[model samples]
Target: MSESKKFSVYLMATLPIVFWGVSFAAAKVALEEADPLLLLFLRFAISLPLLLALAWRGGEAALPTKKQALVLIFMGFMGFYFHLGIQTMAMRTSGSGMANWQMAASPAAAALMSAIFLKERMSRTGLLGALCAFLGVTVVLGLGTKGAKGISIYNFGDFLITVSMLNWAAFMVVTRWLFRDGGYPPLFTIFWEVFFAALMCAPTLALLRVDVGAAARFGAPTWEALLVLGLLCSGLAYAFWYRAAAAIPVPRLMVFQFLQPLVGVVAGYFVIGERFTPWLILGGAMIVSGVYAANSHK
Candidate 1:
């Protein structure tokens, strides 16, 4: 690609990462007033209409075949429903910044899974990078004896976050399998996934007996937070993310993700009064460096 074209691609890819980074702050604000399930319900409920409108405007074709539809639905369940549910739950127990940091594990896990399932191989440098990233995560989480205390066993939020990361990795694998042939537009597939996620989440919302009254009690700031999460983070962010992914090489595009936790950590510190400890910073650096190295090796 030409230099100008490459710069544009980087710019486009940066959008989603920035949006996602800001989302941690927004979600932290939203969760203060809204229940986890309610937060997720509102996010999907608000984004659904906009996503459908975009799909319509794009003149997308009909739904995929029965087999494909089933796969998409499953993908939606794993990626959207399960993933978001776990993440929301995690946020309730763990702070948004920590949750975001933990999520940095996804790309590392994806690389490992790809190697095993897709027969992809990475260079030794890449393996070192992945290791560094893992170490960073450990440090950020405070992995030693003191760190163990930092982990809330009773909270179960951290466990949920770990599960969410695994689910996201699985979703990536499924997405690769379903879209490998490149028959359908990314938006179309994403729409179905969002649709299925919404459908599955509806029952969970009801079961949780989500209180609209609580949502109403939230002030404008909370509402604004939810709006940002729904519109920018979930809806437009995905659109841009897929677009950028298509435009740039996957590894290079993924480097933008390393910025997400950094943004989240800083935002959490300033906005939520979360501490910016040395261990957290050190761990985050390790995780980011490791992941970068691992991807580079590949």
Candidate 2:
């Protein structure tokens, strides 16, 4: 690519990381007034129509084949509902920086899964990078400590977030396989995944019987925040992410995600008054360096 084109792609790719970084903060704020399931349901319900409209305008029609639909459904279950639900729940218990660092495991998980399933090979350097990243995450969260309340003082939130990272990596692997062989449109696939996930979560929301009045009481600021999360972060960001992933190789794109936690952690500290410690800073730097080293080959 030309210098200008490469720069443009970099900007486009970077935008989603920035938006998602801030989304951690917005989600934290939104969660103050909304339950996790309810927030997820609302976010997708509000965003789906717009996404479908875009898909239709782009000439996407009819769902994928039955087999492909099944794959998409599975992906939706794991990626959208399970992955997001867990991550959101983790955020309620952990700081944004910790959550972000936990998610840094995604590339490593993806690489491992690919080696097993796709017969791909991981370089020694990549393995070392992954190990460094893991150690950095451990340092950032101060793993294996005792709490004052006799609660075992473990970073369960960080662990949950890291599990979501594995979930997402699996989702990505399935998506790449489907897209390569199925000839499906990325937008259409994502729309259906989100749509199916919304359907699955509908009953959960009904069970919760979330108070609409409370949701409505946020007035303009709440609505604006929701709009940003739904439209820009969820819809537009996914669009750009898919585009950028298509343009850039997966390993390279994965490196950019390391920036996400830095943004999230700092934003959390400043916006939400979350505590920041030297350990977090040191660990974050290591994680970033590890990710860069892992992806430098591509």
Pick the lDDT winner: 2
Which segments of candidate 2 are over 4 A away from where they belong?
1-12, 120-152, 219-221, 247-249, 273-298
Summarize candidate 2's per-residue lDDT along 39-97 as a digit string, tens digits.
Answer: 78777888788788878887874678898788778878887888878877877876665
Q: Rate residue 70 of model 2 by lDDT.
A: 89
Of candidate 1, the 10-residue stretch with the lowest lDDT total is: 143-152
In model 1, pairs of residues that clash are: 126-294, 126-297, 129-290, 129-294, 133-287, 133-290, 136-283, 136-287, 140-283
Error of 2 at 261 (Å): 1.5
TM-score per candidate, in order? 0.78, 0.78
Relative to the unseen true structure, what is the C-alpha lDDT of residue 254 in candidate 2, on a scale of 0 to 100? 57
Model 1 residue 40 lDDT?
84
